[model samples]
Target: MGLGTGQGLHYETAERLSAALASRTICSVELVESLLGRARTIDGKLRAFIALDGADALRQAVESDRRRERGAALGPLDGVAVSIKDNMSVRRWPMSCGSRMLDGYVSPYDCHVVERLRAAGAIIFGRTNMDEFAMGSSTENSAFFGTANPWDLGRVPGGSSGGSACAVAAGLAPLALGTDTGGSVRQPAAFCAAVGLKPTYGRVSRYGVTAFASSLDQVGPMGRSVWDVAALLGAIAGLDRRDSTSSPLAVPDYTVALGRERRWKIAVPREVFSDGLDGDVRDGLRRAVDFFAGAGCEILDVSMPAMDISIGAYYITATAEAFSNLSRFDGIRYGHRSKVAGTVGEVYAKSRGEGFGAEVKRRIMLGAFVLSGGYHEAYYGRAQRARVHISNGFGEIFRNCDFIATPTAPTVPFPVGAKTQDPLAMYLSDIYTVSVNLVGLPAISVCCGFSPQGLPMGLQLIAKPFHEEELLAAAAFFERNHDFCRRHPKIDQ
Candidate 1:
């Protein structure tokens, strides 16, 4: 299929498109043009992107075509267009992070991830939308606008990586980048029926990516298929001198893990099927378990009591880190300066008061409270201990099982504004995802089944730290037997 037909080009997986580009059946310029054309025609409804640079993207695409013509293609992703989340620095591109605090701020240099993408010859095109400072569970907290779920316009697409997930789900880009601090990547991928992977915390560098929770923040890949996500992960996963937290271990070829035949030992945590889980989601998880068992993989019911306290511990730890990291956005520095400043104190107070959105402000305050002298030992200290406990709990389970399975979220996508009135209800949405971050393990969300309302539900598979190869292999094996990934939302043109 050609770009002119506007049929298969928009939804083709990055893996397939890469091969097509190498063979000269379709050029990188043509693929970018087709996707850009579709974004112009439909992005208004989904609000997936914050900005798009046609000239720059096409310029890079032309270079990719020239490379292929001269037999100098960089690698498999040389010409594929990858959408970037707004928080990652793209040198000269506005790095909004979905907040007004950095209103007109343009990145002065490329972050580590962007540098890696450039090295791989990938054409970076659009900057996707996100929650303000990556604080909220739904995209509703975004200062500019909320991104709609492509599966159902009235519902949310999950956050703070909702825009990236929506872009992949809506076919705006075959592959995109999303930062997962506390299920931001996997949650949205679940809601939108796309595949999202959260590599082990240090597996991907955080040098150029905007931070939410320093210890938990990780940049991950989102795509329609597991293989596409694997390809993107291979391109960006490696050590970066700029980020001390980045791992020094060698990056593996993730695609090689696909189609591996093995009798895997999988663990199903009993805590994940709690009372809060929606009925439809619970049923879907059971079906997934059955599939694994039928495929000759051994499934065991594992108990990890620490899972019960993950949400509380995560909020305390994540908010405290967020408070510290965001302190640098003062009016005296590079961010927004108060236009009606009378004194230095007033500038700092007024600028922050006017710049940050309500959600961002709430998290900042929560973080400060926990880190305060009076509450430091009571909250932050205890949270640190709890995080260690959770990590140890996962270690014990992994000793007997190769992987752990659970529902990505407790419920399917809720209508926009459904839980906005209750912050506690909204916080519970990440119940199943935060623990993985706290423990710094690799995890993935694949479309397992759909809800009665026709919305999608995700099956989350988590692995030991830096064992992304095994995680992707298990998810790919499951994906090959189902048609869920092949289904696309019907976007009105």
Candidate 2:
């Protein structure tokens, strides 16, 4: 564990060392060997980690140098060193839902945020790529790998947590752990500038993740700021009696909700910037609404006709709950089984047609032809009444603006095989964060500007159900009045 003095760790933000590591002066094997040496020197150019535990991250930085020579009590992400996105799950590794029929499937346990980041001594240090099973947007449908876009590798890092937004946009994991069902960790941390979060829907703890549309999945935190996505969402949020949709509440102190009371009101949504939009994502949401109306708050101007049927109501409730949660990868109990089957429906259709991948067999044959039976009431009961009319149009625009800001994505990272044979033009590139994951509220994206082809451009914020500390203090007040983390994308420096 002698990377012990990796010198003044750059970009690390857990409120500047969670009280300077209580007294460890930066020794968690020097921040997990300087983030496993920038995830092994730029993860072969951003194909963001799918496994590289570096001897279990130097044996958990040598058990936090033996609990700091036996003083013990740590936890506030103790040795903090996050990163986990291979559709989540961490225990004996390989929880591959990026499908090759769960290529080397291994999980047996751990994943209530990997047991709260290994009981807050945090260091999962590996597994990233996503899409298959997590179902695309762009981690380029991950049959196994292909993340890129660490600020323009040929564009597109936005994704099914595009390798956890190119591992915290190529700083290579100062933080990570994404999920978001539709916006897949805030559209790959806004096409990879970084600072995601989706929470709210049962506020973090989907037991062991890996289910795509479980009433629109969650599990937030991606970073580079916004107090390191609210200190990795206050160390993986709470209440998980092993997640019966967790959320029993009382998990505040999200970095004390970012210097509280910068005062807010927000809500812009005139049907999400009507028209094709792409003049730098509409001048970066009109310069984040004129820097939040020159910082005195109050922006109002709502309306929501279910935002014109939220991308055909989120592709008919996420392909009818991804054809019933990918029908538990039928190849016997765990995953990958067919070595020429003798017919148990020919080993569940030839081990998921030879372990899926053709945009995951065309979204599992269009979600088994739209939930079969003569098209289950013309597509999953009309996308569950357009998810209660877009959850009452975000409950009537959070009742006149307590949050709503928009533009998490309209266009900016597309170019890696751009819209690969147009899957409904990449499912209308998640039409502005898929109706806040079909009504389970809470969003967040951040960055807020960029794109003249230099990519990057975010700004989402949202709120409502369980609010994620008022959507991370309204995206940390436009990441502190429009400085926007000093403009990222110059090949993620």
Off by over 4 Å in 1: 1-8
Model 1 Cα lDDT, one tens digit per residue, 1-493: 4533537588899988998898888999999999888899889999999998999999999999999999999999999999999999998888899988998899999988889999999999799989898888888888999999999999999998999999999999999999999999999999999999999988889997888899999999999999999999999999987889889999989999798967899999998888999999999999999999999999999998998899999999999999999988887857799899999888988999999998888889999999998999999999999999999999999999999999999999999999888888899999999999999999999999998788999999999989999999999999999999989999873
Ten-residue stretch with the least lDDT total in model 2: 1-10
List TM-score per model, in order: 0.98, 0.38
Which residues of candidate 2, in runs, are more than 4 Å off? 1-25, 28-54, 59-80, 88-93, 96-174, 183-266, 269-294, 315-317, 320-334, 338-341, 349-366, 371-433, 436-474, 478-493
Window of ten residues with lowest summed lDDT in model 1? 1-10
Expressed as tens digits, the lDDT of each residue in 317-430 for candidate 2 is 777677788878989997888899997999998998898888767776777888888888888888888789789878877876778887888887888887888889888878
Number of clashing pairs per prediction, in order: 0, 0
Error of 1 at 5 (Å): 7.2
Report the number of the highest-TM-score candidate: 1
